[model samples]
Target: MSTNTEARLFSPTTIGAIGVVNRVAMAPLTRSRADMEGVHSELAIEYYRQRATAWLIISEATNISREGRGYAFTPGIYTDEHVASWRRITDAVHEAGGKIVCQLWHVGRMSHVSLQENGAAPVAPSAIQADEQVFLESQTVERPSMPRALETAEIQRLVEDYRNAARRAMEAGFDGVEVHAANCYLLEQFIRDSTNKRTDQYGGPVENRTRLPIEVITAVAEVWGADRVGVRLSPITRAVGDTPLDSDPEGTYFYLAGQLGKLGLAYLHCVEGQTRGDNGAGDFDFKRLHAKFGGKYIANNSYDRQMAIDAAESGHADMVAFGRPFISNPDLVARLRLDAPLAEANRDTFYGGGAGGYTDYLPLADAA
Candidate 1:
């Protein structure tokens, strides 16, 4: 394990109990390619199975409960049918000798009036409203409504939802579970301030803000074991309905990373983007945070092949996760390995669609 540049790319690494063949992971990007009920279809199975060459696959944001739904057609792990649908994909990946994990999520207040259970308003850490305009079909709509603050009891329920999702994921034959704390989801809303306006124990300072994520992580670890559970955090992505961030995000997340390290979880996944909704990587340094979270570090957002490989080689990241690139290049690993050109992603059919731009992206040969 020489700390040399070439060694970085060629190095074999272990993140907790899982062994990665190399440090390239398929980042979880929601394609909304599932059926309306959010079931994993044959299309998804084929899509993921093609990338078995990657070290691991983090499945798209999956709801653990009905109240967790935010985006339409996102998959769920809360129901029996959902588990059945997922098992097909996991089984396919396993047969191909690929490892995968289900990313457990609760979108919190990032939902619409029509997207919730019984069309109820979305829920969050507090009642603060974030009026992020989200796309639905051919229309742009403001975020559903001001979210109802969760009672202490409801918070506990959410933790249980995450735990149950972990159990179900294992039952469906997933290798592990990654708690989705990144991108201003439920956990981020709790961690960041602009959105979390509460006087309770779960709302104030950094410890309290981080409490929910820790509890959920601890709970999921109990089910899947710490070595098999991972957590993804985008310290910079203060998304649409999420929260505002720190004046010193680097120090903030560095502290948070140190805290997460104590749990002995498998890996700590992060992204290099501002939490602000500027469609830009927030302008802050990630050097300190990267050094501290020293386990398997997975970087996401706006990364291409050479840059991703550079991150891995520089020891800044253990692996690189490609979000948009993986969408159009199911054989993305092979493409990168062979230095082949990638097919451009179809923005038109990215979401709410059949296989037009979804599963129809051919490999390099077909593209030619």
Candidate 2:
């Protein structure tokens, strides 16, 4: 076990304008504990507060607008009421001496009509259906409804939704925001050529295909200076609905990272491989992608303690993000420093639930 002074993971680092106490970050995990109105429940305050030891907490995938939702009980950031609800959670995290950022999300075609407004079809870059399923209000999984191609004119409105969500994140007292452009979501739908078959400015070649995501990021950067914003990307993840990899994962993502780097954003959070699976699932070079960006990198996806320590010591990553571990070990930073055994989280209680597996897990000290 490495002492606090021995582990480079305990060292402080600056992610853009935000100075973190350590290189450990809590990746976004969808708990589906929000109310029907998309407001986070009161239990979330303690849930996040318990994990305050992390250098940064990237909030779960949050909806930017009503049309952005794909799963039930996920939080939204569009309404004033939503802002007020999130403010309390942010206050709790801050009071506990933690920094957090909201992850703006739009599920695109990965939605069911039952979860949509007026049973409307979900919108996507093309009118194609995904091979995935979404969780409905009843906690049952159902196939996604067919989607309609987004009109070129509506593209600007989607950008506006992201901009407005960033504005609301500011109002809610978050330290910063992460644009969720990964995992076959709305942004990724437009980014990958497999799903996007449009002939408009947002389709075809790599340049045109990445237009919408770049524009959305630009709009978000306009609200919170580029230095305070971060973009999350998964170059070859087929996690949701078996979304196929881009025709050229290396070419597409390297180009995208270079473009984002030019915007002077804080950092690029890359899911190294499959979301909850393999870390070396593909042949793409993440180091080259990081080099292409020429900025700080937060390496994620199944990173264990030694891997994280090595990444930090070798300067391969500025920070490392842990997902499921954070759910079972709120004092994960302390455990890592002491080399303590981590508790496993209950898979059944991972989704919509009360305070069972959410916050009942004891810290190392309490467990001892």
Candidate 3:
């Protein structure tokens, strides 16, 4: 590729009010390295500081409350200790000249009994059990236990939890937050009819199904402002416990894009497939979604240097987020700029480990 072509990926852009020097954004990846208390250790600060060259970095999916946790050692943003720990992380990233956003998550029915308080069932939009297993530091369940359906009033409270978490994120010194409404989590469970069989105002039709996500997004946007808030959506992903497809995937998500556009959020981040390159969900019409959103469009899942460059240069995306690639290539931007060979990430130490595969990845200068 020519210099001008590659320069498109390196060009500066603004997502809402935040000014970024390039369109390369780091996608959130779960490393599960936090302490049992949900306090991130110094290792996390080093891990993020290593990848601070990305124009923007989205932190791992962080629980907003104890009830939201589905995996062990994942970080949370609810307590004072958690806030203080995360402040160090955000400060380090900022000091390294990078912008980082926290991804707020609630795992919903994707929980095992061990993860729940007092052995209580996990909460979800409905009582459906995902055909998936939950992995903890000590054990793994064959399949997730059935979850308790959330009462209408309980959902109201959960929305408030999101708002409070956003406040906590700001207190922790994060640049912004991305609501994890994707991957069969609490919000996505409500949006899909197969999971939400309720007859009340929060189920049945598309309007009812989408109500929870809109309310949650609106609540978070209120705390952080819409310009500083983003939402991640998986329109056709079934990888996370085979989260059933929406009856009308097109209608459901198109309407969601339109509704999100009205909120004037900073951007809409979409995971294009299962993992990065496997489009297991098949083809999607990005143009329609772009038109519906009418805001910044961030494309994720399996983008290479050329693919990202093409997407930005061709006007298909306003930003591109790289996941696993950023794991091993802390200087991913520099490597792509020079067309250098990349490092391979070790699968064994991808999660819940020390600095082996986490912060040990050397930058290009060090390797050379």
Candidate 4:
């Protein structure tokens, strides 16, 4: 086990059933490029195939059902058509020697009424309105709609929905599925004390707050097996639609990570440091989580090539996930290895766009 920079960053490793040639991963990114029918296009196939060099590529946060949709043109995995559409993308990645996993998501209170069913209210652990607005095809609106508190029965159904979606993902040819428990979505909304004010067994104490997420994980694991599953958590980020930081983030996530560890997950993706800037947000120690998690850590958020090398060489993370870099640099893994200049990503075309900024970025040779 050489601890040199290249050795640490490029060494092959196994994460559960998936094998990686390097420690570079592609973080799940929402581009809102799916069709109106919630199906991925051929463009998505090429988009993923171009970035196939990543050790693992986590697909964008995909809705599990119509009720789970929070933004326009985001793909879903709950329908037969959706499964078929995703097969093309998965087949392309596999053909290009890549491993990919779909991220199961439910927006919960972070949704707007326009994206809901028949202008219905979104659902959450409680009826609290998130201080966040959702993105629409037309425009980004403010003042997210007030969500209805999910009944105990509906909560059970949501867990079942996750199971079904995982099954569909496997059918769609994904290597596995990653539970979207981070980024102030449905699971995070329940895990955080500030949003979950329920008096039932699914709220109040940390155990209660963690209940829904655990159930969802268990159901998804039952479908994909624990070894093929991964969980993502953002312990300190509060920028997703003004999601508030937890009063006891350290305690809440440590306990959660320890619990997830018991399930034998493939990896735990932790979004640490500042959301958009450097890794100097606060006193939060992601290394402590790596220890408690007792599994491979995929560290994400604002990581450069050197920072990624440092995290792996120091045993802080087994892999580093890059989002924005992958957007502009299709050959990101090669570029990082050679320390080549990365192409600048056009933020304007990041979401709700066509291939102008999606698959149009040239590789190193073309750029040269």
Q: Choose the strongest candidate by lDDT.
A: 2
The window of 10 residues in a row where model 4 has the poorest summed lDDT is 273-282
- Over 196-250, each residue of candidate 1 has an lDDT whose tens digit, in order, gives 7778888777778788899999999999899998999887676555467755566
lDDT winner between 1 and 2, please give it: 2
RMSD of every prediction: 2.9, 1.3, 1.5, 1.6
**Which of the two candidates, 2 or 3, achieves a greater lDDT against the reference?**
2
Residue 25 miss distance in model 4 (angstroms): 0.3
Q: Measured by C-alpha RMSD in angstroms, how accurate is candidate 4?
A: 1.6
Q: Where does candidate 3 stray beyond 4 Å?
A: 1-6, 139-142, 276-282
Computed on alpha carbons, the lDDT of every model, listed in order, comes to 0.79, 0.93, 0.88, 0.89
lDDT of 2 by residue, 1-368 (tens): 34454787898989999999999999999999999789988899999999988969999999999999999999999999999999999999999998999999999999999989999999999998998789999889999999999999999999999999999999999999999999999999999999999999999999999999999999999999999899999998898978999989999999999999999998999999888887872557999999999999999999888888888888889999999999999999999988789998899999998989898999998988
Which residue pairs in candidate 3 have backbone atoms (N, alpha carbon, C) closer than 3 angstroms, thus clashing?
276-301, 276-302
Residue range with the least summed lDDT across 10 consecutive positions in model 2: 1-10
Q: TM-scores of all models? A: 0.92, 0.98, 0.97, 0.97
Encode model 4's per-residue lDDT on 1-368: one tens digit a residue: 44344568888888888898898999999999997568998899999999999959999999998889888899999999999999999999999998999999999888888888788999998888888567875756667789999998788889888999999999999999899999898999999998898999999999999999999998999998888899999998887868888899999999999999998999999888656666652569788888899998899998888888888888888899999999999999999888889999999999887899999999999999
Error of 3 at 32 (Å): 0.4
> Which scores greater on lDDT, model 3 or model 4?
4
> Clashing pairs in model 4?
none
TM-score of 4: 0.97
The segments of candidate 2 whose C-alpha lies over 4 angstroms from its true place after superposition are 1-5
Model 2: residue 33 alpha-carbon error in angstroms:
0.3
Decide which is better by lDDT, 1 or 4: 4
